[model samples]
Target: MSKVDVQLADVSISPVQYQAQLLAALQMRDLDKFTQLLDHCRVDAFSSVLESACREADCAQFVQQLLQHGADPNILNPVLLQTPLHITAELGCYETLQVLLCDDKINVDALDWLGNTALHYAAQNKDQDTVLALLEHGSYIGSRNHAGDMPVSDIEPETLEKFLNTRLKMPNDESLLFKYDFLVPPVALDSALLKNKLSDEKDNVIKKLSSPSPEMDPIVQISLSSKQQHLLLHPIISSFVHLKWQHVQKFYYYNLAFYVFFVLLVTFIILHHHITAIDEHRKSCWLNLSAVCFFKIIMITLLAICCFCLIFKLLFQVCISPVQYLHKWSTYPQLVLTLLTINVLFIDSGTGDSAVTVITLFLAWTRLLLLTGEHPAISICFHMFQKISCTFLKHLAWYSLLIIAFSLSFYALFHDSKAYIAEKNVSSKLFHNPLISFFTTVSMFVGGFETKFLPFETASGTSHIIFIMFMFFLTLVLLNMFTGLAVSHVQNVQSKSELVRLTAEVNAVFDIEKLVLGNPVCIHMWMRRLNLSHNAVIVGIFKSFVYLWLSFSWLQCFRNIHHSVLLFPDSSFDYANIVYPFGNSVNVTWNYRLDHKVLLQAANIVQKKNDEARQQLDCWAVFESYEERLNNIEASQLRCEALQQEILQLLRLR
Candidate 1:
């Protein structure tokens, strides 16, 4: 009898012998013998053996016969917890895998002990045909393995190409036929694998399943987290903080409206205070004390809330180093306003009526103008002023010494003349006071002198001569020198206006980022409180309106008027161009920049070629690795052959 026939004949006699017979029939490609052996043995007793044969022999007919005879194709191995499909995919048994897939009972996405599916194995092995077959049989592409990697992620370029091409070529109509109805199965741990239940292996498996997937890009994850955290804070300011520059430009009008409202409210409060002071001065009972106090309280409360917002912003700026934070121009004004607010809140109410308080209020109002720096006219004016101030300070040291010498010389010569002018009531006493004499002399140089009030007739001739020289030096020489310095600074600022404007915008964005987006802990706590408040909706709406108003330009109308004047100048009127189609010739410059366009196109083409070359190199590397693995397998097979020859020689000697 043939070996397969003899094995089949003895199948009923022994379970082990029956499995051996079934493997022999599959290896020989004897479909009849394989089917007969399967029939003789119980389905469960020989199903695993049939699966092993299918994996090893590359026999599709044996797998099909076993499936027809009621062998469970989805049966997992006791040791590895892997199904026959996983084995076939790993071994590159494409035909056997196809046969197994035809049976709907098999779980194609079944996870092995490592949480890897059949498709993952196929991709890992770079078996293009097997990958395509698995994909055609409704395999999920996004299934993640234990390593948090999708089947196609981090694979060889050649294998990735095969996967992409197969997906692309799949017809829309045929896709419905292979639609997967995915249902995750509970993981079943093998008793042999998990013999010691308290071992680290169990904990490892649990941790693997519980951990977040590493498939997300790190940058995308961080951006998403930041967005979520911001959403939990004050949503309106968060929106403004994250707005694109183009959108911010378009939305400036809304912000302007907010600033106007804030300024009007402040004006109303100041007027109320003035009226209250007038009533007290006249000793009239026109205003009720209680009503005035209540009004003051309401205004103070509103100011306090505004101050709180500013303080929150300052806290965020604390993330930056002290020197860096102090370097910003806006920080100084903000700090002053914050300190003024704190003083008003903690000190006596009468302090708000003091001259210092009034001066501080005026400063706070002026600081609001800084928000309009985005306007070109305002930005240029500010740049010019800053330059002039810096230049003035650089020259102040030498100018001070010259003024001091003239003042001391005049005071010494005119000291005795004060007695003679005392009866005339001409205030010649200024010469007796050193500090006052210095100011009076400087003022006289600037054309503040009144000859009727001066005792020049009574003073000595030396004093008169010294005063004339001082006036000439201070007015003609020093005044003109300062004027020339200021003019030079304006010219320098105008030449570099665009650079200054860009730098201001960048600095503004950095400050806003520090204030609005920094301090996650504070934002989180404030958000929590905001969420719990009953008036949150009304407060949010009001806050949004106020914030939008503050962000807008109060002088936008004037800026627009300036822009119009520049566009249509009275001196250089282009009447012919205005009447004709070509109103302005400036747009032609944009089209003339062909060099830039050509350079951009060349860069794009070069980038595409580089990407293609990199892909080719990756494919070559994969092939080289495969060749190395094949060489190792061949060497191992030769060693086994030599050992077999030695065993035969030992048997012959015995």
Candidate 2:
């Protein structure tokens, strides 16, 4: 056909005809014809034709040509929602698959009409190369298809064994390097060397900056400031946003210890204050006063530290997003504790020791239990309790209103009755008071009132019948209804235990992120310094002396008593030589030092790795910000272009 005839013929043909011609050209491997047909076809027609080509054998070059011409690799089949990647994977077209997989825009795990990913189809057919290609491109092996089967589940036994044995090699292709930058493995360092290097660097910096140095370079000063900023901000980033699992677990243990100590110290202070109030003789004693003063100082110091940490955390949350900060359940507890601690500091104990302060202390202790929501069993129980309590309270509110109305009417009717007045015992008179009457009636729902104390015993016959009806409705009907509702809610909670636990755990993690990680000063940093200090040696010696003295004093007191008992273990392991089941024994004296050193080295390695991961994540976050900005600019440009076109149309009409 002549060029004019070819162009006219393409225009005159239906969509099916064009698709057939394009497919024929693709299958024949006629690049020139394929290129011509693509030029005359629309994107939808070209996509359908390209998908058909993927299904045919040895059409890899045609697929490449289509892709190079800007044909989409992700276009779905109209019926199956299958992309060319999925089709090629299913048909075992390895060459075509390779071309499609190389395209960054192609989704390696794209699902079809059956919700089967490309990997799913490949695994089903036992297509080894296609499966490897998909996996290399980051396809998820655990994803369930429509039939609820994982890709691995579809493979034959032999193929499954092979897959299990296969070790996925990291992609080293230069083209894919940028795609996997975030997955870059951190550089490993010798644990002992890393610690020494870090300490030496810090000491050198401190020594150089201790005095004014006119010779210090401006670049060096900026670098030092940047390093300090990174060290200060790394914990917040790692715990809150990135939430690396290992780092989270480490922080959890650290915070758990600190929180437990805080709770115990607070409890001790509360009990001591109560004891001093009751025992004036003990309060007057020198030892008692000194102990109280010492404990008070420790409690105040701990409270101050916690308040300082909380202030920084609050500021960080508010700075990040005020609305989200307020919405979090954990924020309220911290805010209350902060306010209460500040209030307690300013107000005298004599003036401030009211029910409110007591309640605040209780709340502070209860908040500690919330941290245990990270445990699945604790989280499930918490969810069930929350659900049941909410349901019961809602029903109770309505039940209370109805019961209160009836109680009020009964009080009005019987207030002046001679029989009621004559039966004015302490319990009987409670119903005469309005507030007490409401509670009394509520108590009746739980069968709290005796038959002799019932309002009907003193009222008129008509009032007696009304009272019976009210009791039946409130106690029998509404109470049972409330119980049933709570039971239903409990069942629902049980069914969704996993989901609820996950949500609770996530919230707990976020709370920890805010409270622990968001602290301006890292507690672990001070702990490490304290552990390496000479003063720690002196403190340890003093602690040992005090413990020994207390034990001796306790033993002396027991000897003075007529009745005393002590239990000793029947079996104990010898410390000199530790024996194993294999009859191998190591001299504890020699192995103790070696084992301790090895443990210290291992700990240092883990700490170093975590620090490196945090640094890498910070770098990745910076790149992500740049990427987001570029996307915004592209979107803005498209919007501006459309507006410009609209303005041009309006001007032409005018």
Candidate 3:
């Protein structure tokens, strides 16, 4: 080769070498090498290489340095067809672009080779955070790029819409332009042929809805009406909002019953104490017979009231819903408090000896469990457990704390008691033997209202142990029964929730039948307005109607009566006969069964009717689109005519 040819080859290879070296510097992520190279290269000459580097990796810092050193910020790299900033942004080098954007000399709104601005690149990448940053920097959102696509067009329409809607709703974002821009764009005009096409779509919808899932019962699915919203809301209403006069009456009666139970319980304890006193000749003979007879009368009266109230409460709760159960349950602690107060008032005689007073106080203490729902007496013991280092240690600590508290409270009130006033009575035991006090206190705490005398072989030690065992057994049985009830209730709730889900699925797939009688929506809506899910069949019958009215009236009477007691009756647990506990004729067990039969049939009819209404609504939506398009066409034509008139006027003026 000639020397002139060699020089020309070197000249041709120089640009390629420069480009490769710049790319290497960028690939190395060495900011300093990039600065030195860009300082030497001409703006227009190296623009292609710079843009290519930006495209391959984040080169916003390099681009900014070059721009500050007098490289043209708006210059395009012809080979790669990208601007440096545009490529940097598209690659999501957010911080690099942030520093570059700080330079006032750079044209922030400059478009890349693809006709996309930096804002367009950000939106296309779904980088909303970057898009907001670009907008904040005064990037022109409306400006079309080389491809005639605006920055907004780069955004996913749905995401953009949601963002804009959120912004519109914010009090600080009062943008009239945004409001006008989203005024639901009109659909393109469609002909009669298009309406026929919609009929085909309706048929498709019907077919899609016709097939029932194998998991769903086909018979039930075919029967539901479309208009039935979930009736589960009924339970929520009863729980929170519907605290009717019925609830108030039940509370009043419950409180009265609880008062009677308290009185009887106290009398029973006092009688045992009196008998012990009589045996010891501690009380005067005259005081003994009077007190004993008074105790007996109190016991009998209390039992009668308890029975009456229990029966009343059971009658009231028979057809109630779970939601109403929660409402009624909330009143229990208050009722209990009232009962406890009544016992305290009658028993707090300053003349009574420690034996009589202590027995009365301990019986009253048992009412503390009723305080469980209102305040967490149980939680106090649990909290102490948390401070313990190990699991078993925690349990041990909790039981220790409970026993200690029980002993302290028992001793504080009953230290002077002389009955079975064991060699270690409250005062002596509390001062010298805390362990003894704990066991004794636990025995009394566990011992329920059943403190009847059981003749043991006349040995004091043997009798004491037998009494403690009886108390433990009684407490355990009551606690176990409560736990069982709670478990059963939770299971019932789960099953009911699953049943509702199945019902909803069935309703979604149901078919419709035309009725000559009337509009099903009107019928269904009327039912909803009446709030009559299970009240109908009961309301139809005279006996059931009378029973409901009586329940309401008795509730009113309870409200009016100053001293009437309420009793809750035990409900049947049979699912088929179960009654929901809210409203007239609703029993959890009974209403559920009734609802299963009647609701299924009624909902099936409603579902079909609702489906037809929904289809009509869909048709209306299409019609609305057509009318909007016509309005837009007419509006555009008017604007064009006005523009033409303005031009004529300008010409005349000239």
Q: What TM-scores do the predictions have?
A: 0.40, 0.45, 0.22
**Which of candidates 1 and 3 reaches a greater TM-score?**
1
Residues forming the 10-long window of minimal summed lDDT in candidate 3: 510-519
C-alpha lDDT of residue 162 in model 1: 35
Off by over 4 Å in 3: 1-16, 79-81, 108-115, 144-149, 153-654
The numbered model that scores best in TM-score is 2
Ten-residue segment with the worst summed lDDT in candidate 2?
563-572
Q: lDDT values of the candidates?
A: 0.54, 0.55, 0.43
Q: Please, what are the lDDT tens digits per residue for candidate 3 over residues 530-585? A: 22224555424632332343345344433322211101111111211112222333
lDDT of 2 by residue, 106-126 (tens): 866565656677988898887
Scored by Cα lDDT, where does model 1 land?
Answer: 0.54
- What is the alpha-carbon lDDT for the whole of candidate 3? 0.43
What order do candidates take by lDDT, descending? 2, 1, 3
Q: Pick the candidate with the highest lDDT.
A: 2
lDDT of 1 by residue, 133-224 (tens): 77666565555544445564424445433333232211232111111111111122122222332134435433322222111121111223
- TM-score ranking, high to low: 2, 1, 3
